[model samples]
Target: MQGHGYAQPLKRPPDTAVLIFLRVLFVVIGFTCIGFASWAMMLRLAIVTRKSLDWGLFVAVLAADVLSIVLLGSEPGDEIHTAGGYFGISLLLGTLVAATAYYLAADIRHFQRLRDAYRAQQPMAMPYGYAGPASPYTATTVPSSPAAPRSPLGPHTPPPMTHTPPPQPPVPAPPQRPAPARIDQVRAELDELSDYLRKHDGHHEGNYEGGR
Candidate 1:
């Protein structure tokens, strides 16, 4: 006989704090530096990992870096700097701070959305009647066979049937009689006799006297 036992729960991988810290360091450096190398690395990381927040951060950082460079370049030769230069420096710092804050807010929002989606996808609890991981001690339920479908009529009643008679063949009509030609022949003979009398009436009377 097979021995009964309980199934062990599956183990999950541990979240590494060091790896996360290194990733954050790299992102911070990329944001601070204005070089193409850092930008390329950050862009690659963002794209490969499908991190929208990273992309947003890269854009914000790039904009701020470019603005700062432009502002610094606009300053006149390295004197103690004028009021305009001081204002420009302040503006550049403000831009950097604003950009960082904007991207950070975006990252937080993105994180929230991801977290919400993950929670939505996770099963809250086992389905109402679903049997979870079965244990040897758990009782197996034998589902009752569904009752056989019942007829609307009584169980012993016979189904009603309609009787239809076979169709009969149609009767044929009687043949019609042909018209007579004898009347036309008699009329023709009478016409010919009248024609002969009209042409030779005197000859006929003379021949009769001679015969008397």
Candidate 2:
């Protein structure tokens, strides 16, 4: 009861202080990780694809991360007093930011180009909104030739067939022979009779000796 009564209000940090701290921390961490990832990606691309542009851009991004870290860690009065330090920081950070945007934009452009290429390679029979592989089931929208009839209602209809073709003659079956006399013949006949009775569309006789 005494502790609860005497409990003091929590001393929360100022909003500006928290915001500055978070902003610096997030930017520093984000740039560092992204820069390193870009560097590794560039290395892979260079080794595999032998793309000089990617390698160059990757180096630029990495330099940016280093510049940001240095600038963030500098003493309070160092940036103002040293002209060389100020110029170097400004150039490196600015270049890093610009290069990052440029490469990202380039990547988007390349992706769109690849998508367009893929679309071109697809079969023309496929409709615009189709989601599966090209097949007869896909809706086709190609223009028809002039020889093709527009519609039955608009164009002249074909003359109705005055005479219908005669129905096909019944197929002739080979003549069957009479069953041969054998020991299994009697059993087979009994089995056939039982099958017929089971399948017959008639009321079955009750197996009772007498009916009410």
Over 164-200, each residue of candidate 2 has an lDDT whose tens digit, in order, gives 8889999999898766676479889999999898866
Error of 1 at 51 (Å): 11
Clashes of each: 0, 0
lDDT by residue (55-123, candidate 1, tens digit) is: 875676566556656666778787527766665566556654554454445544545565566666666
**lDDT (C-alpha, whole model) for all candidates:** 0.60, 0.56
Q: Which ten residues in a row have the lowest lDDT in candidate 1?
A: 9-18
Task: For candidate 2, list the clashing residue pairs, or say none.
Answer: none
Per-model TM-score, in order, reads 0.36, 0.34
